[model samples]
Target: MAPVSVVMVGIGGYGAEYVAALDRLPLEKIRLTGAVEPFPTRSCAEPGLSERQIPVFPSLEALFQAGCEADLVVIASPIHHHISQSMLALNHGCDVLCDKPLGASIQEASALIRAREASGHSVRIGYQWSYSEGIRSLKRDIQAGRFGGPIRMKSVCLWPRTLAYYRRNDWAGRLRDVTTGRWILDSPLNNALAHFLHNLFFLLGPAVGLSARPLEVTAEVCRVNSIESFDTVACRARASGDVEVLFYGSHATQDSYGPRFELEFEEAIVAYKTPVGDVKDEISIEADGRRVGIYPSPNAGDHFAKLTEAVRAVTGNEPVECGPEAAAAQTLCMNGVHESISEIPTVSSTLRRRSVQPDRYWIDGLDGDLRRCYERGVLPSEAGVSWAIKGQTIDLVNYDHFPTSENHA
Candidate 1:
């Protein structure tokens, strides 16, 4: 109601984007109370926030003590800090709007879910694609049977990350192991492809839960440069969702064709292939050997704007579409791809939908040592390895990238 009180964590890069969204929104409806950054020296010394008037607290607790009673805690923190920061915020009675890939692993994500349930507060994962006007229109059309009885889904995501991209930040390839004080890639799936997978389910609805499972997955991990993690991952997932669904995504390419999402159904083909800009939500559907086109009504908000609405829903005691449960399901799908990649069994096995096992391979050491490092929340270099995860592992990887100075310059 009264301008959802808000505190933001990590005000650099993506965090800065949230800051701008908060500023652009009705300031009277959402207030930026305070912010938290561990490196106050770097943050304060940086010229980006020179004009920002809000006080910058060095710790989460410090902000709370300073009377920052926020109804919303928007975590734009690093991928690793997302879970911990979200837990702290919910525990402190603040509703949360988290960046995508809520946690590195489903295990970590479960902890956040437990916290939210215990606190009885709302939590929204930042899968803004599900909220996009274009996506919503497509979903509506599909439900209306505009595409006919059976539907097939196809997701194409091809983007290039140059060697310079990884060299730009020390944390780029560095794994954060909270266990054994070591860094590992145990959570790569979430950090990399959570949104892409989740958007599929959001559009289609309970895909894996029903009659079909991901029968087989063929993945190709390409190392375009020195980044420990795969700079480009192309996967072809074959599943039985109503008819059959073939999905593909590749994050390595100089020539990217479309907006990273498209769907082909039994009747017609619907696509969203423009760059990241405003576009009319239009779909071409064919049924019974007849073709039809539909245009979506106009809406004022983009992804972040939809996120603000979710925050309001949480504050108003309403259920969130992208809540923890949905997030966990998304995480499960993400881990499925990771597990498939790791356990590249010479023989493929058929299992029920949503099957996840405890993965220590993602940790270093055959034993619990790497898990211990991850639980301790130490950076990768401290864990005696450059990067470690189940399906992929690399040693002595280079973290040199464009300097922060250059990024700002």
Candidate 2:
């Protein structure tokens, strides 16, 4: 068959990583045909694109207007543009591979589901962990009853960010785009550490296909930074099969723990822990009184590799491993988190604040407090913080019954 043609939207930052991954693939399998980047000469200019001689367009609309056709469209654009861009690509008779946090709001997510059903084109979300070989192996073990069914699952991460990180773009830490008036919940649970949360849901059951859906969620969202969204969050959700899921993440710490996910089964415990900000890690399983480590093969964590697989699946008219249905649980959990809190409460002045650098602030003792929460497998309130507020519970058994309003707006 001819090489599958791909057009990328966005070519800077994370987009550049995609370009490097695509470059490593065999040219006869997939080829880059075009890009949508308004400032190609700026930070977005990538050597891979220049070397491949891919044409650049100012926007997706511009590329479509030029009558350029592609077999697949990969969108690495901002969080707020995902749904619109994915719909545009599907309308043009192209399958889509969009970045995570499928949509900024539940309403937008529902709309994308509707569009995909109407277009009959495959749509995949960029949740790299869901595509990792190590994760897949773990799923197989769970399905084979190696662990004798999961009892509970926990995902914890403590990643710190400087104020400049939020300043990278106008939408970095915003809840709503002032220019487009669209909802953009750029928070820890939704954007930065979303993969960990999504992976927790993916591990419950139905391992080979779409992940288990969320049934309910109770969460507490707090903020110490000046951003519109919360920097610290703790959530407990119930998934299909009566499995309980716990998530605790924060961007307000002085120390970083990277990301760790643990699943406790009736007979064994499966865990994956990595250095801060690293996704490529091995899984350790303790079953039948024996411990074993499973290492991922080369390029197992390469998101571009997963994207290429999705493209191949679409070309072959096969089902993608991480499609729209697999990602719906994430959207429901995120929306439920926001619904749990009417407004984000700020930390009390008792928490010491130190000026790390110009425009950057760090909360003293926050790292230890967060670690305590993880060790105890509880939320901040349950961890004995005087200022912590109890979270609200939400039932998502009837997902469509949840409110679709822009909570932050």
Candidate 3:
């Protein structure tokens, strides 16, 4: 077998991960064809494309126009650029591994699905956790009916972002891209902490490569930061089969805690990063009122499995574990969330505390409160938080298309 020629879109930010992975992969099995980055920064200078003599183009369109033959194209571009680039790659008879939250809306995701079908090529979404054998093992058990009827599942993550973090890119804290006016919806729910949010639906997926659809979403969204979009959110979604999914994500905190989750099933309760010291990082399961120790975990840290799986999928004609249809669930919930809370509120000034070093602000007691909500299986509104705002519910059944308007104001 010959080496699979690969092209990468977006070589800065998270694109650096793909670059390093490509470098680490065996050269005989993987050949670097080119890259698409209008501005190649020094951040990706180490063992860099320049040193490797890998050709870098200004855009994916340019690469394809130059007839850069590639079997696979890895996209780590801005959220707004995903659909366009993936469609181009597919049109050029190349497989795609576009990055996560597939796009800002379910409609965009559907278009990519259509493109994949039309092109007769593999199109994988880069949700690394979905490619993990550990998570796959967990999902298998759930699908096998070992966990019994689903009750409820909730996840909480409070990762603090500094001023510079938001300032690094134009889309960081935005509800839409500034220049392109495309729906970005870059927030903790959709961006940094999306793995946990998407995991809930992915695990509950009836099949190996699908996710539970969010039928309706209710959410409270606010920001303490100096950004256009909300940095904190508490969302409750009613998925298919009457399963409840709750997600609490916030970047407006100093205390960094959790990407933790607790999933309740009739026969057992499963948790990740639970308060239990002995099994903090493992997928801990408690069945029939007794706790079972952690199972042999999946090597989730080997995120390059996303790329490797995509390579295997195309070269070996294997099914992609996470495709456009599977990734659309997260986009659906995100679209409904924005519609549910069109008016993003500002967290109470009195409750927010400012910090130095990077000029960030945080809601006092928020991290602890979110952790408490996770343990208690409740939303922040139900937990009686002083600054919590109740939001409307938006139905998402047969939901498609996200109106590109300033609704998040």
Candidate 4:
């Protein structure tokens, strides 16, 4: 069989990682035929693109207009471009691998689902942690009732970001992109630590191996940093079967803690903790009176390698893991978080902002406060902070009614 022809959209930063991964794969398996990058002058300098001599287009629309053929489209563009780019790829008769969050809002996610279904092409969201071998094993054990049915799950992370991180792009740390009219709610829960939240729902699978659907969501989101969107968030969502899912995430701390999750079942508790600032760390599972490390430490290669395998599965007409439907839960919850924004009152006085560098401020006590919330399995409000406000509950069924005036670009 001929190698799969791939057109990558955006070849900068994370996108370049995809390019490098594709270059490492056997030439006969998959090849980078083309790329869509708005700033080709900057992107062309990337080693992968320059070395491969891959043709670069100004945009996806331009690529399709020129009758460029591709078997798959890998979208590593900004949060605003995900749905539109994915739909464009599918419309052009190519399968899609989109970056995380799937879409900025549930409405956008639903539209992508419609497009993928109409096109009859597979669409996979790039929540790479979902493809981890250890996570897959945990899913299998959950389905097999090894833990005797999940009761509750919690995901927590406290990774700090410098001011430079937000200043890198126009959309970073923004609630909405005024220029594009795109909903870029680049908050901790939705962007940086999103995989941890997605994993919580992924583990509570309603079907044998699919991500669990969120029935309802209640959350408290706040901004400690001088950003439009929330940097710290605590949420409680009820998944299928009345299983409670808790999430605590922050990007305004002095400490950097990688994502970790705990699933409690009737029979036992299952938990996995990765090293700080790395998701690919060796995962040690604790359950049933014993603890054991599973899978070798993951490297940068694991993510794109698995993505390549997913593309192969699509070509062979096999089930592609972590497809759009599996990602809908995260999108739904993300929308819920946005909807609850109005209800979340501002938090002040509790956070002492100390300058870590020239312009970056880290919340001095945020690390300990967040750790308390995770340990006690409570929201910031429940953790007894004076400035914290109680979370507001939102029903997932009302997802379509979410304010779209601020969401559309």
| Top model number, lDDT | 3
Tens digit per residue, CA lDDT, model 2, 157-203: 88888888888888887888989878888899988888888888877
User: CA RMSD for every model?
Assistant: 13.8, 3.0, 2.3, 3.1
The lDDT for every candidate, in the order shown, is 0.54, 0.80, 0.83, 0.77
Of the candidates shown, which would achieve the greatest TM-score relative to the real structure? 3
After superposition of all CA atoms, the RMSD between model 4 and the true structure is: 3.1
Q: What is residue 361's positional error in candidate 2, in angstroms?
A: 2.2
Backbone Cα, N, C clashes tallied per candidate: 26, 0, 0, 0
Candidate with the larger lDDT of 2 and 3 = 3
lDDT of 4 by residue, 145-176 (tens): 87687888998888888788888888888878
Instruction: Give the Å shift of residue 350 in candidate 3.
Output: 1.4
lDDT for model 3, on a 0 to 1 scale?
A: 0.83
Clashes of 1: 26
Model 3 lDDT tens row, 54-137: 778889988988888899999998888898899999999999999886878777788888988999999988888788777888
lDDT of 1 by residue, 237-287 (tens): 444454433333333333343334446676666654443466554444444
TM-score pick, better of 1 and 3 = 3
Model 3 residue 289 CA deviation in Å: 2.4
**Model 4 regions more than 4 Å off:** 44-48, 276-301, 343-350, 356-359, 404-409
lDDT of 2 at 388: 69
Error of 3 at 380 (Å): 1.7
